[model samples]
Target chain A: MTEGVVVVGLNHRTAPVEARERLAVPPDGLEDAVRAVLALEGVREAVVVATCNRVELYAAGAEAESLAGELRRHMHARGGSGVTLYEHRGEAAVQHAFRVCASLDSLVVGEPQILGQVKEAVAAARSAGALRGRLGRVMARAFQTAKRVRTETGIAEGQVSVASVAVDLARGIFGDLMGRKVLVVGAGKMALGAARTLARAGASLLIANRSFDRAEALAREYGATAHPLTDLGMLLQHVDVAVCSTGASGYLLTRHDVATVMKARRGRGLFLIDIAVPRNVEPAAGDLDSVFLYNVDDLERAVAEGGRGRSVATIEAERVIAEELSAFRAEELAQRSAGPTIVALRRRFQEVAAAELERSLSGKLRHLPEGDRAAVEAMLDALTNKLLHAPTVALKTAAANPDGDDVMRAARSLFALDAEPADPRGEVTRMRVQGEMTAKAKAGNGR
Target chain B: MLVGFLAAAALLYLIATVLMLTYLVGVASTLPSRRAATVSLGAAMVAHVTHDILRWVTLGRGPFAGIHEGLSTLALLVAGVAFALRLLGRRLETLGVFVAPLTLLMLLASQGVDAQPAAPLSGALLGVHVGSTILGTAAFTVAFALAAAYLVQEREVRQKRLRGMFQRLPPLEVLDVASFRSIALGLPALTLGLVTGLSAGLQEVGRGIPIVSWRHYLALGVWAVFAAVLALRLLAGWRGHRAAIGTIVGYASAVMVLVGYFVRGARL
Candidate 1:
């Protein structure tokens, strides 16, 4: 049988966030979910990659169709309704895994968080004892491929998030952000995210909110100081970048306030990131000298343009994924054939040992007690196991190399193990061609 | 032998300029090392100083005597000021992408000046006049580089295309402050230099020699432009792109005054 990967998942494109949440595996529940999936029939290895926008189970096994059904039942018991489940097997599954790890399949393609989430999923499965062998190797290689894609292609080019784009705009206006002071007008999510990005870039953060306690709470989280809303004017004068995402009915910062601040600032450039829905900063404030104001719409336009630029690099990104998938498939094929070859070789050794033990038990050991005869049989079995240990390890090691099939062929012919049943998928024949071509290429290159 | 040193300095300046340009364009995956660029530029300055001293010794005159010496001295002063500003902070180092090429051009132009027999010694007034003006022009050159960078970076912000070159430049505040400080120092030097030149011209006229030329008037015009920029900035708070463009115009006039010497084929 051909061993392949199977992915059964539901993402933002296939289901709404509400539906995804119903199937999402919480951090505390991840190990249990992975263990449950591994207990199912036909799932040789399992990893549950669950996030806010997606819930997916990836497995490596002989049967994709049945394994997907088993995963679907697991997902069904978890309370997802009206959600479309996507099932990808073999090459499609491998391709899907690569694309997801590379962030090409994210809701916002080219976003970088998915790769880290995938790593976390793999770690959880490993701790849960559900990740092993072929699946583990494939996932580890997928992480490397993701990193290569990020470095070699523009897949991760530009800031795609509104918060990050705001920070980028601030840098453009301020050059280096180190030691620059930033003022947050509210403690809302968008404002906080933008502030965090700026703070990470070395800008000092000052949080100002309507509620003093709320501002203090967020300030402690970011290791920043909190100020009252009334201090906005003083803060604006001292800050290089100010982000406003207040939940107010009117503008939090008006043209007159910024004009006064600019005079105090001596016309130093002030970047204002207004991410609120109703717009916190006054539009006319941007008209003031040395004030660069970008509302949510402007940030979205930048994000959209950046997305379009990244789409241009998709062809190259897809080519990278294709190369990684081919390597993974070849390795899987070799491992599959090597596994059966090891089993057949062990069986052949056991048959000869058992035959020799049977003759001794019936003739020479006939006078011995029943307990001694059983002990002799156990010794023969142990000897057979001990003899196969080095060869088993050698065969697996050879399978990882280019000429692994030669070793398999020699062992089969030498032990007459070919008469025994082996892998039903015909991987032996595929590996034969692959190994011979590789060896031939190496020989030709040497000459 | 002096030409060989000049060639080495020019080559080093060219490399530094190329590295800075590459950094501005964001073509390199990693940032080009600042230490390498700084070392290259510093070595270039040392060689240029060596070339100037050697030429001074060989010619047995001051480095400001002829068009050749004037150009070389001007290049050295401009590059030295730029290097000093860079040592103050890295934000000004990007200005080298503009300053280094201009320095190389001046050095190259110096080679084109014809060697001539030394004239009779000039008065102390003439020495004071020429030295102060050269120093003032060097300060103006540094100001001009900062202004150009400010305009480029400011345009990127206004257009909201914050990538590549925009990302490499100093902040608008930093550029604006540096430009103003340069003009603040340069305007006084230039004013003093112009006054000395006027005094020198009066002395030459007393001796019945014509010393007032278009270059003198152009130098006065350059002073007037910077004076107006400084005056308006102090009076009206003119501090951004408009101020930058004004400084650039002033620097342009100063450069034209230098070019006037080469065009007239006269000794300074």
Candidate 2:
């Protein structure tokens, strides 16, 4: 089930966002896209994962590598023409699926949205009747792999954006943002961004701007209060965090202003976020007691640091995905290799039991009643099954390891079963041919 | 027998300290996990209190009597206060990095001093002076440890390069408040100790001792440092880094008083 899995598409890394946007299929268009891929000859099972950052088609079939070209062509025709595409086949393909589902392949390596996006794609493909057999099992196992990665690793530990990092810094200072008061100095984009994150963290926000109208407008959105810029002093004394992004030319709040407010708050910690262009808050204000002030550059540096921290976890996540892929492949190979061998061994033993029963019934048990003879034949068949059970169990159990394939071949040859299952699956072909020859032999003998 | 318990406690404290360092390093952490370190520290504290009680009973005197007893008692007080704070659910247990080793050091320092027991503290004023002074210094010791934590956490926040050991600390606000509270507790105790000491000095003037000995002056110094910390925190906005540094300085004066007693009592 893990083998012959293929993914052919372009992501943010392989193609630009413009290219990705061109190739992206809308949510409603997903089933149609997957059905189109399934219509191709060598694509037995198919799914289309199209998000803002990537567009991919996953397929499983007998000739999966061949389907990669067709999937690429199909994607190009669906508006990915100028975009470069990448393809992974077989074991590499299975690993690519795991990485994608785990979000190691996303532009933001540990972002969580990719997992749900791919899950939707799988659902869409299932709806289109294109998800069955190997591809379906592979995706189900991929979800399991993704779940393990999320729980077992620290890949998603830190906030990566400026606004979210502001929240993280506040929590580091205050432990919890619940009921914490945040003062936004100006109604600019950066200030609004920071205010939104803080308000979402359960903080009560107060928007203060020179234009009272802008403050009131932003305040209405957060269900918070609006105050004029002149009220910054009284407001600063009350709030735990003050985001200063005003467009004032000089220091709107000087070191002395912050120091006075700190004294008013009785030295309770105040976090000042100066994300303005001309830097509204004075740089020296950070030196005051219980005042933690961070400017735009400092916040950006912290954001970058968070990115570097996740890279270490990214390596750990990669190791996890590698382990899951190998485990998945081993289990799949065990079923593929041991399954047919077990069947052939059981057939050979049952045939021998049947021939002996026929000879005995005709020559020695000629005087027995019909019912008694039928019980004897049932007992012989049960003996053959019991005899072959141990070897069948051993062969399948051994198939879970690398050397299990060799043991499977040895078990086949020991039973005089024709050919090996590993040689492009010649065991099935040989079994079919042998069955046909056996039918001809029975006809010629006319027993 | 007291030495036996002390030695066992010192050994346990050493093991607990080493285990804590390893736990911080992310190694040697298994089923006998962080809980083992906490248990060992608890046992060490138990043995420490037992050693103090045995000596107190043997001599029929409080631990405030002499330099050895005073240092040993101070060590126990610091550990007890820190452990209590942790049990109160403040995320400040990392202060044990300073408390544990300092307890061990003080125990060894106490043992190095003369062993002959000083007579028990008599006269209510003198007893109060000794008791409150030692208690006040113990509180200062806690403030000192918290100040160190505040400095580290403050640096991490100020420099904006928060990596390992940064997240391990309690938030800057928590550390600042905790350090300030320790100072708050110490200030009153030291003030009471000084007032009683002054009353005694005025009543018994120049009786083989000057009214203002070096310890009296040092106690005043510690008092003044904490006084400035509190007044500035309330009046001049001195609370985070500067306040932590001030608390550390105040605690240093308290340490000087202990060293003064330890050295002077040994010579006597």
Among these predictions, the greatest DockQ belongs to 2
The sequence of per-residue lDDT tens digits that candidate 1 reaches over residues A200-233 is 9999999999999999999999899999999989
For A243-291, candidate 2 gives per-residue lDDT tens digits of 8876565689999998888778877889999866456788899988678
Alpha carbon RMSD to native, model 2: 16.4
Give the Cα-based TM-score of candidate 2 against the true structure.
0.56
Per-prediction DockQ: 0.25, 0.32
i-RMS for every candidate:
2.2, 2.0
TM-scores vs. true structure, each candidate:
0.53, 0.56
Real A-B contacts recovered, model 1: 0.39
Name the weakest run of 10 consecutive residues (lDDT summed) in model 1 chain B: B114-123
Clashes of each: 2, 0
Worst 10 residues of 1 chain A by lDDT: A438-447
